[model samples]
Target: MTSASVPLSGPRFQTEPAELYRELRRDHGAVVPVSLDGDIPAWLVLGYRELHQVTGDPVLFSRDPDLWNQWPGIPDDWPMLPVIGRKQSSILYTVGERHRVRAAMISDALEAVDPFELRGHAEKFADELIDAVSGKGEADLIGDYAALLPVRVLATLYGFTDEQGPGLVTALNDMLNRTADALAGKQHLAASMGQLLADRKVTPGNDVVSRMLATALALEAEGSGSGFTDEEIVQDLVVMFAAGHQPTADWMGNSLRLMLTDDRFAASLFGGRNSVAEAMNEVLWEATPSQNLVGRWASRDTQLGGRRIRTGDLLILGLQGANSDPQVRTDGSALTGGNSAHFSFGHGAHRCPFPAQEIAEIIARTGIEVVLDRLPDIDLAVPAESLPWRPSPWLRSLTELPVHFAPTPPLEATSA
Candidate 1:
């Protein structure tokens, strides 16, 4: 009921912030008031159901990135803004009709895509990845498998070769991991992608890049205002790569760990390849990769959960807290089989613009299926307690998961 804003503590705001989230959930569920850095006062929405409503409501929340400057905790000179075109243009930062148009284009393209078409390709990738790590009996899941796999698939989607995937991964990780130096990496990624777009404009191909180029050209030819320029195209590229990789990688690791650690769930998931679907839902619910509170700024003075927030106040949604809420899954009946309605994919218009949500679900389900079917009783090389966890606020991922497997004949492709 306090109308006043409280200052956020320094230790509370982190690159991969999680500790503060735990505290907020334990202390306040409706709307916990906190400060960021030292002076920025903001309200953290802790419940999952409320978080869903916050993300979905555009009238109450504005997507404008400039509002951060008004907030004390975040630096006004944050480099990622201009470099990623968060200021000039980016569908994620835009609101209303503009967001709608850009989203329409992406949704149309995704609709044209047949997720099943990638089945054989995904299975093959799964096989190759698992096989490469098979003999070693101990592989760093994050460094070796999870981190590398999605980027490779993304590169293929962009019509790039397997060899180019690692470079792209490195560039993206360096940018996101180092928030202070994000601008430099953004420029590097942008320049390279601009060249790729220019080449595609000259001679188109069947890939996401070529498709985006064609879309830009057609929009411009129609005098529909300036479409995505080379830099804007690059921004999307940056988002796709950075957004897609770590989250899914984390999901794979977390999901695998859950099945292994929980006997009942393991029985369901490891029993058959198709059985992983249920376990996937449980893992996603329990350890959502997107653990950070999503950012929003108030468009006007409004009361949330009885607390009055003035116009321009920054707000963050406690995603992790919401997922674990008993109210969201009250009966315990849903997750009785370990199922949950976690907002890992986000909600409403600003949800994942790419087909990443669907793609990740498929990859996680299929990837785990492949491993379980092929190597049924393979124990983790390193014990779960010994596995290292990444200290990231936004992602729940293991640094490495080493596992040892006894030799076994490959299962028939039919089972996969």
Candidate 2:
């Protein structure tokens, strides 16, 4: 890290990040020293090989943001507090054997989700969202469809009523965008989760929270006897809801954007489902929803990508940068499907759990399929170059994905 560190600024990081990432790699090699909003320093790991090394070794690259050496300088009202905070009890900062048990609890609860039921919920929500704007003959898919779908399914799966989904979505968006309302949003979400937990304790249901609450009681059977508390479960739920919603929503929007604009997918968009999966996979590699992750700290002084990282230094996981690392994509033609090696999901034990990944996939893919089924003639409402993306260093999402389609009738609401 040096005085010449990149300022991590500009709209280019959002609108056209690929070129920016390329330049960063060219000038600074794999791990570029960078400055955040307040000139706070960190490393952005851009090399596929280096990112693999960083994430693969949990001991060397720690997840505890408290390990950050710059923390003492961070203020009480810092904007990045939500992204990097102290005293957060979520599983994200949990370490060692405790983290392993927590991971198992999460995995077991998610794995228990009946695939048929999960898909059924996804399809239900997708159809309902599509039904909203179908009659208009045109819609901003990002707002009308993509952004509204995932969290609804997730909320329902977590025992929240259908009516509660919209409010949760609003709160989550505010929280993730890191705006003035962020703390309020976080408080709102926490309140909602608290309410749900209280309700489930009184009378459990067939949902993720109910399962987690029940399973947390059986920690001895789950590899630990100490177990966890209800507040801990609430924190985990908040993390799960935040992680699953926005990225999956963006995955749907990004994939649909790709299908609508790219000629390779245009031919099949209206006729068949053959190209849907390929387009989704391509988004994972090229325009991954999670562009970067608020990330690992150096457990000790170490050298990565030829840069000396002092103990407790922050290292943000540059997922998109790593995926597009020139060394890995030497051919540069871009991968389609059947190649799941992308860092879109993090690596090693601390990675997004497989079941959670599957849930995101189901929500995203099902939303795309529903749109194609309902709006067969969907096309970009504006020129491809005019499409706007949300400005953020962490998430890659469109501000709006406007599209026009043949007028269709809205479907009547029905029980799933």
Candidate 3:
């Protein structure tokens, strides 16, 4: 069949993106043709093996921003990504070694966040959420609980008041949703956070931002070759907030939605025997956040998957496809096991660092067993088919998930 004739089905599963990717691998194999706006031609790599080979070899599929700048289809004025001297993907554009130096400076701050401590925080939040939903007997878990929780945690850590976290999330979502509009939303949020960081610098508080700023200042004092500029630091702040909050929230929401449908998986996870690792792998495999292609431009003439790619060719790494490859799935089952090697987080040097660990705990701790223990009878208030799903290429989230359950009892009075 011609490339255009390849059937493009919508996302697979009630909550998994892997099945959709598996179909792509079965139909297209290594490289699939894509036609973007204006008939721009590109090749999407749909095999896990191929994506690994390309991402690991940065020399072949360079991360340099100039390639994106030179991409043919992007409009001269469009802002799908913010414009700096280089591409938004460029480390320098975000903060380069300065970012690394800042990260190092705050290493102590981050290290202070013991997983046990974070677990306490998450459990408290989850408990309160369960209590809230219990009374209604039905809750839109994604809206009523899941999405709000992580961002609140992140905001508190970052020195933002709990009230501000949701606003920041809404702003970031707006930017990401309007990505095709040339990132106007990102620019707007950048301006707002830039102001916030400057205020924090002058009137420092005991929050994550203050700690990071202290780290930045110490790095500057050491005469390091790499230190973040004020602008770069602010940009990195925006990145941290966005990167930290969204995917995990989406993963939790999706995982909960999926488990509500499958009783066996729910029983094992919430029963607490399964370590957090098992829950994480399964949820990440099931949700597959980085479901869209990672865009790269050919640095030079190269042959891949037996196809010759000339200089300036765009190569989209099919993360979703690789994660769902039948070869990657154990016995072709959706159950997370030895063969489940999905790339919900992009592979290699740039894989998501913090959220992977933190979110895994949230999912592991807030499993079917946990939910059932606290809020049994929590079934879909409406048919799964009635829920609205977000349409972004990179990730998936339910716009809403209404669920019915028992009301939580009122908290008893306690002696101080």
Candidate 4:
């Protein structure tokens, strides 16, 4: 079948794509043809083993979008441009020496962050957020809680003020949604980051932004071509902001949904039969927030999962599809404690930095725990099955998570 016949990103996949993935796997084995934006052809890797092979073999399958042979024919205003288009400063779009240099700088800056301290801050933020909504009988968790926690924590870590949090959220959301004014949002975000970088340069602090600036300067002093400019620093910060907050927010929402809807899983956690970590792992395995990853281009003509691949052809890694492969694990159990085999955060040299995972988990777990503790009687305001999902190829986000809980007095009359 041709890619034009398949719809990979739309309302159908948004609400329930698992059945479609299963049918595709059955008909095409591990690798299947799919279309992005309805006409852009690409291969979707669905097998657990096959995804590993492709991500691990950078020589055969490159992460550089510059290698995309179809770029010349595609228009600049393509709907997927924000995702698959190449950016000279983005580590996500680079390969080889460029990737290695930028990745190291980011890794070093992240390693400097103390996980324990970060978790403590996240917990405090969680408590404050809960306090704000505790007095209300109901809330939209996606908006009031899950959505704000991550961005707040990230802003604090990046040395941004509380006043700036809302704009950051708006900019990041617009860019992710690829809205009509996404370009304007990007420009606004860039201007904000540039100003922040300037402020940090004048007055350094213990935040990630300061650390990255230091590293960039050091690389420049060493005469390394990988040295970062102010513009480049701003780009990396944008990446961190988008990558850090969006997935963590979705993960928090997904985990809470599981606890509220799945009796077996919730019982296991509340009955002391399983830990929160176990529940989180299950969410990662079954309903990964970032359902698909973009832009892994073919370095040369090669075969993958028994399918012919030409040089420059794009390959999209179906993360959720691979984790749910029936051949990998049967019965679809959610209580499979602490299994780290899933590709939720990806694998190999290009795997998400360890610091990102640690911070995201701490924020999500702490945020969820605070809500459950403060509002022990929380339940879905509407039937779980009727809940709608945002129609995006990358994220598995609920449009809203309406929930009800017992009314209590706010800890203080302040906005979260």
* Best-fitting candidate, scored by lDDT: 2
lDDT of 1 at 295: 74
Ranking by lDDT: 2, 4, 1, 3
Runs in model 4 lying further than 4 Å from the true structure: 1-5, 178-181, 267-274, 413-416
Report lDDT per candidate: 0.65, 0.88, 0.61, 0.81
In order of appearance, the predictions have TM-scores of 0.84, 0.95, 0.80, 0.93
Off by over 4 Å in 1: 1-26, 69-88, 179-188, 268-271, 332-340, 374-376, 407-416
Model 4 C-alpha lDDT per residue in residues 1-416, reported as the tens digit of each score: 33333656766677668887888888778888887773878898999999999889877889878888778778877878767776566777767877778888888887787878888878887887777778878988888888778978888888898789878777777776677878887888888889989999999999888999998998889895768788878988888888988899999998888888887566543434345666678889878998988848899999888888999999998999899988787876653677788989988778888888888888898877777767756789999998878777777778799998888776554343
Greater TM-score among 3 and 4 belongs to 4
Which pairs, if any, clash in model 4?
Answer: none
Q: Which ten residues in a row have the lowest lDDT in candidate 4?
A: 267-276
Query: What are the C-alpha RMSDs, in order, of all predicted structures?
Result: 4.3, 2.4, 4.4, 2.6
Kindly report which residue stretches of model 2 are placed more than 4 angstroms away from their true locations once superposed.
Answer: 1-3, 178-182, 220-225, 413-416
Give candidate 3 misplaced runs (Cα > 4 Å).
1-20, 69-73, 76-86, 89-109, 128-131, 176-192, 199-207, 266-279, 335-341, 354-356, 363-373, 410-416
Q: In angstroms, how far off is 43's CA in candidate 2?
A: 0.7
- TM-score of decoy 1: 0.84
Model 4 error, position 343 (Å) = 0.7
Candidate 3 residue-wise lDDT, 1-416, digit = tens: 13552322244533455555555555656777664444556777877787888777766776554665345556665433331224553243333344344545544555546466566666666666666666667777777676667756665666766556666666766664554543665776677667767878999886667776777787788886565567766776677666666677677776676666555555543444453345556666655555564466777888877667778777777776766666666575666654445677676545455444454455345533345577755677887667777755456677788887767663331111
